[model samples]
Target: IPHELYEAADVEGAGPFRKWLHITIPLLKPTTLYLMVIYTIAGFQIFERVYIMTAGGPINATTTIVQLIYQTGFSDFNYGRASAEALILFAIIASFSFVQFRFLSTDVEY
Candidate 1:
């Protein structure tokens, strides 16, 4: 943060909450958005953790798309279903990216 901003805030008698709410949070908007997008993409592609923990047992409750693809392709030896599931996963990721870009891709001014 620039010293001038805090100095001005201090001069204006703004409290810590006020400075954080009005200045700090606004300044960090871009970083927040970037992290949100990155995490969203990563969250959708999760597989190993769920696989190791649950392995989609008992009813396939904890299965992820990637895990389903693995089971379909290798375990069941059904390449066609795995390919279709992969395509579906791609479509889902693409749609999410499109929406995020459409709404959150606006240029933020400092």
Candidate 2:
């Protein structure tokens, strides 16, 4: 799909921005939305990478919500707050997944 679009755009001398807006983006919406959800969940759970790379330092530049939960629960011994944060995260993920599934599962009748 992308290759065909790119070829057509190239033949028409379309610029990259025009090609993306007119061809690539429309064709890639489904894949992009799925990947966006996956990346958002991954970002929410970012811990080890930040720990190993930044130690959540530089005034918490790399501090993630998951890292904060771990620090609160284990380091500060605040299990209740950590649990609340976890529940919030779960609710966000569940809502996104439900919406994505509902939209993707619909038939696009031509």
TM-scores of the candidates in the order shown = 0.77, 0.60
The most accurate candidate by TM-score is 1
Per-candidate Cα lDDT values, in order, are 0.85, 0.80
| Candidate 1, position 49, lDDT | 89
The window of 10 residues in a row where model 1 has the poorest summed lDDT is: 101-110
Report the error of model 1 at residue 104, Å: 3.8
Error of 1 at 106 (Å): 4.4
Candidate 2 residues lying further than 4 Å off, grouped into runs, are 1-37, 107-110
Compute the lDDT of residue 2 as modeled in candidate 2: 44
Worst 10 residues of 2 by lDDT: 101-110
Which pairs, if any, clash in model 1? Answer: none
